[model samples]
Target: MRSFVRAGYNLRKKTGKWELKVRPDKDSMLGRGLLSEKEYHDPVRVFRKAFKEYRPEQFLEFLAEAVHFSLGPFNHAPEGNLIGPYLHLVKMIDAAWLIVERASAEK
Candidate 1:
């Protein structure tokens, strides 16, 4: 299936804690709020709803906030509205794993 939002982990600059960074992929149609029904369902509506109820930054903020930190930059937005590399760390699996685990456990 096609991905809507790309999610990953990042450091909250001020608090110096790791946080999720979710962003719309540059080539994704979801980022533009242009998903076709035939392409997918729930995801289409999910992103559609997100784009309608939340501004792109609000999505970004939700994706980054500690409250929703597990959401991550990897799959930042359900609708694919958020985007970022936040950082350029190539070898991030170790850190990413820890963050994802914590976020999942919190949920």
Candidate 2:
């Protein structure tokens, strides 16, 4: 069994709505205890290890393009269905950027 820590953040929508997100960090206290001291001490290394699970750089570029296209003034989205996907993309890119920043900071 895995343990996790729940975290929430406010995401503002273009329609003036606030989205509440609950993110799982760990499965439980046991999971926390199971992690090594080095894993806990250097978050950037941990992030890099985890980020390897995804195509971070590619995803970052993809999300940035999606956001640009979706939010562009010339785009025709009168109904605003694109907003949700745009926000999600932004969040993913932000996370990737953070990881990159941390990795650079470690140097």
lDDT of 1 by residue, 16-79 (tens): 2323244324434433233333212222233333344544455345445533655455555344
User: Which candidate has the highest TM-score of all?
Assistant: 2
**Per-prediction tally of clashes:** 16, 7
What would the per-residue lDDT of candidate 2 be over residues 49-83, giving only the tens digit for each residue?
43344334433454555557677575553433445
Q: How close is candidate 2 to the true structure, as a TM-score?
A: 0.28
TM-scores for candidates 1 onward, in order: 0.24, 0.28
* Candidate 1 residue runs with Cα over 4 Å from true position: 1-42, 67-107
Candidate 2: residue 63 Cα off by (Å): 8.0
- Candidate 1 yields a Cα-based lDDT of 0.34
